[model samples]
Target: STWDSQGEFYESEGISKESVKLALKGSKMREELFDHYYAEGGEEAVSDDEMVKYLDDNYLRYKSISFAKTKASTDSSSSATDSSTDSADAANEEAKAKRDEFLEKAQGVSFDDFDSIIDEYNDYVASKKASDSSSAADSNSSASDSSTTSDDTSSVAESDTSSTASDDTSSVSDSTADSSTAASDTDSSADSSSSAPDPYANEKMMNYGTMDDSQKDTANGKILKEVSGMSTDVATAYEDDNAYYILIKGDVKDRDTEYAKDNHEDLLKEMKSDEFQKKLTSWVEKLDIKVNNKAIKRYTPKVVYDKQTEYYSKNNNS
Candidate 1:
């Protein structure tokens, strides 16, 4: 009702009479009020830098109320936890005293004799396991005898049925023989059909250079892209996982000698096998295989890619 007269100013400034009253209570309250104003202002709010400057100027006494509240909360929580811990410790001490008194009353009590007690328990456990195993074996033996008897009865019945079936089979054999001749005729036809010419027969001798415009596709039917040194004479064949090439040597169609000469300007200056081996050895010698001792020890053997062969022989072989 009071806000109706000053409603326009209150709405624009985002400060009602109730809010102003609360804010005037203390500097902390005023800062809280400013926070609410900033949040609600939206488009009417001042720029962030201007807001910060204004807050700095006006709220000089607003000494981080959030920090104070947080510190108070942490202190109270710690105190409560410490009190609970103290009570629990007292309870535990009382329980321990009662246990010690009970133990003192018992005669010939030796805590050090636990090892012997454990050994006896283990022996009992082993005896129980052995007893269970023996019972299971006896049960299995009885089951096996019962199964054998059933199998024998079934076998006798099967023999009688088989004898009857054998008579029927004799009759069927004559008809089967006629069908076998028909199947043999079908097999002959299939064999003749299989003798059809191989589609890839032309591709075996066909090299890239000798291939016509229409036949310039790869073995898998991909379009042939021209490369300067890749000649037609080199017969490419693939089998298993390996690519085999037959290098044809001739006067004009000499792929090996001419291609090498044309493609490589310094073909004569190529590295020899011994020289390459020496270079490889020198490069390998320069390599620093930094084996981190801590790192190697941290991981399990299974996790490591390069496991020692002896580990498998020792552990898995057993």
Candidate 2:
């Protein structure tokens, strides 16, 4: 149709009217004539066949431009997809790096150090017990001296008495001596009882520093697991002051004497501190744990044992 239209336009120009009519007579003949005309330069004196060839070449050029535009669009889409994929991969890698760093930090702690500290505390308790016993012994010696002086004073008073002074002095002196001896015996018994130190104090104090490395590792693992599994709200709450208080309680309770001597009101105040809870929650989060249903359902005996040991140690020291 385009070729016929071009032939009509050529005839209206009044040049080669006969050739244009012959060219349009058949499609095959027109195509062959157009090729032969195009072989020569497209000059002003060009034949109708040459003009048809020119128009067909222009059409091919337009098709090439369209094809180029389609190719560019496809390439752009592919590049965008690749960029998105690369970005996602980078983000995932960063997340993994963060997780690994947190795990490493948590795993670095040693429970053996904690145990050694507890041993030092136990030694301190033993020394304190010895000092208390010494003080008790000193007090008893002073009491004994005062009793002896009182017995001598009573004997002198009887010696200065009237008629039965000799008999009274002897009888009174004997009774006074007997009373003094009995008083000394009673004081000695009291002193001995007071000087005896608590048997469990040293043991309890020792527990504070006695955690094993394996136990600590296990605990660190558990903490990370828990943090990983926590919901946003619960995790936030865990990092608050309440959690810190629990850790402090666990720590202080490990020292038996300190726990016993510590005021209940003070403990309550510490427990209520927001900072303590926040510290605890932060610590737990730092563990970078992820807990699943299976881990929760199956109680880990080693963890339980460590916890119980910690509690016992705290209570003993307290």
Candidate 3:
């Protein structure tokens, strides 16, 4: 027996120290006073007094928690809260009813029926192109009809100024030049009129080594990065913020090798030039470099005449 803080001999044999530790481990309701009473650093039973205190404290804590919960429930069951909840419920029901009515009109959406729908658009563009060609032919026919009116007008002018034939010819030349210039300025360039632009033009054969973060995010870059590992004909259904897309991968070619064959030397030269420029800039910034303004001005080609005169002088000397 040991004299505790209470100065009493509290013996224990029912609960082991290991049992108390295990109970405390699984419980939030712990009395650290138990540690003060019987928590020795060895295998021994907790004092019966400490065990009694632990159970009593846990029961008191449970009662207090239950009282707090009951008070909260009573406070929250007020008329205002109930009215707000009812209003929210009514709003949700009304929104659901409207959605149901809309579904009745749009005839209910179906899953597993969505696609890129690009083929239909391509067909529509081809039809429009054909119609535009027919319209252009009609416009050319109208222009041909206008030319007959111009012929009669020109004859009338020629007759009125019969003696001044040279003057009339000069006037006609000026008029023709103005009309041609106007036509040249106003006429639209022949639009591509292509049924479809090359889809692969934007994504074919990336030089992935030179790509930066921004480049990796552009030109279907995200899609290409994924498909780079996949074999041809093994595609993925990809989606983004705007729309869903089905990426059908094409045959792999050593386009990178072919491109490097033609352009590797030029690319290397450009890289070397860029690196040299960066190094030069860094060196210039660090070094005490002052420009000889007099020398620069003396050698500077301010104008072509300034250099041309020297060239002429050299030629004269030679």
Which prediction has the highest lDDT against the true structure?
A: 3
- Model 2 residue 64 lDDT score: 4
In terms of TM-score, the best-performing candidate is 3
Model 1 / residue 15 / CA error / Å: 76
In model 1, which runs have C-alpha deviations exceeding 4 angstroms?
A: 1-109, 148-318
Off by over 4 Å in 3: 1-124, 128-203, 242-253, 269-274, 282-287, 291-318
TM-score against native, each model: 0.16, 0.16, 0.27
Candidate closer to the true structure by lDDT (higher is better), 1 or 3: 3
Worst 10 residues of 1 by lDDT: 62-71
**Residue 3 in model 3: shift from native, Å?**
99
Model 2 CA deviation exceeding 4 Å by range: 1-109, 148-318
Q: lDDT of all the models against the reference?
A: 0.31, 0.31, 0.34
List, residue by residue over 1-318, the lDDT tens digit for candidate 2.
Answer: 544545434433333656555656765663344334332342223343433332222111000000000011223588886775675445444433432333333232232222233343235435545665677667666666677555553211111111111221101111122111111111122234576743222111111112244432443222322333433211111111111100001122223233323322232222223434465577778897877878555547665566556655755652
Clashing pairs in 3: none
Model 1 TM-score on a 0 to 1 scale: 0.16
- Candidate 3 lDDT tens digits, 66-172: 00000111236578677756654454444334323333332221211111222332343355456656776676666666775656432111111111112211011
